[model samples]
Target: MIKRLTKHGNSLALVIDRPVLDLLEIDDQTPLSVTTDGKCLIIAPAPDEKRRQSFQSALKKVNKRYGRALKKLAE
Candidate 1:
């Protein structure tokens, strides 16, 4: 697919439309990490550190809650 760059101040910006944004599940506030190989540009959603930490915290609690039962089952 071809895309045209629009002017954003002096620099050009590639505008991503709603369909593409919806497909990626990212919105305007979502942060992205951008990089490129010699031939192609790679774009992806950056890790949400806060969300990761919260999920890890929740998982640790679940493990703590069930650790004894899990250990007994293993044995």
Candidate 2:
């Protein structure tokens, strides 16, 4: 889908269509990461706070289980 870039004060913006927004599971207030790989553009929704916390907790658990190994490796 093509979207025109319009002026918004000092910045330009492209308004995504509703269907596309639904497919991307993004709402107006959703946080997103945008990047360009060569000529292609990438847009992805930022991880949810709760999900991020869960991942951190899981990582901590794994680190604790392997703490002795990690300490040996560090030495």
Candidate 3:
């Protein structure tokens, strides 16, 4: 299905339909993370608390193992 961006003040907003929202398990109370890959946009339900913690922990270990050089490259 196709969606168009509607005018929202000075910005554009895409209206997500109900079926897509349901498939993503996005309830009104849940938050979403919005990001872009330069060429495209991504919208997803935020990871749960446990999963977020695990990801941050794993990232710290990896950064420590790689030292500061890898982090510099990311910048």
User: Which candidate number has the best TM-score?
Assistant: 1
Clashing pairs in 1: none
Task: Report how far off residue 52 is in candidate 2 (Å).
Answer: 4.7
Please report how far candidate 3 places residue 24 from its true position, in Å. 0.6
Better of 1 and 3 by TM-score: 1
Q: Estimate each model's TM-score.
A: 0.64, 0.60, 0.59
> By summed lDDT, which 10 consecutive residues of candidate 3 come out lowest?
21-30
Question: How many clashes does the backbone of model 3 have?
Answer: 0
Candidate 2, residues 1-75, lDDT tens digits: the string is 567899999999888889989988899899998899999888889778999999999989989999889989999
Model 1, residue 67: C-alpha shift (Å): 13
Query: How does candidate 1 score on lDDT?
Result: 0.93
lDDT of 3 by residue, 1-75 (tens): 878999999999889889988888897888989899999899898869999899999999998999688978999
- Weakest 10 consecutive residues, lDDT, candidate 1? 35-44
What do the candidate models score in CA lDDT, each in turn?
0.93, 0.90, 0.89
RMSD of each: 3.3, 5.1, 7.7
Candidate 2 structure, TM-score to reference: 0.60
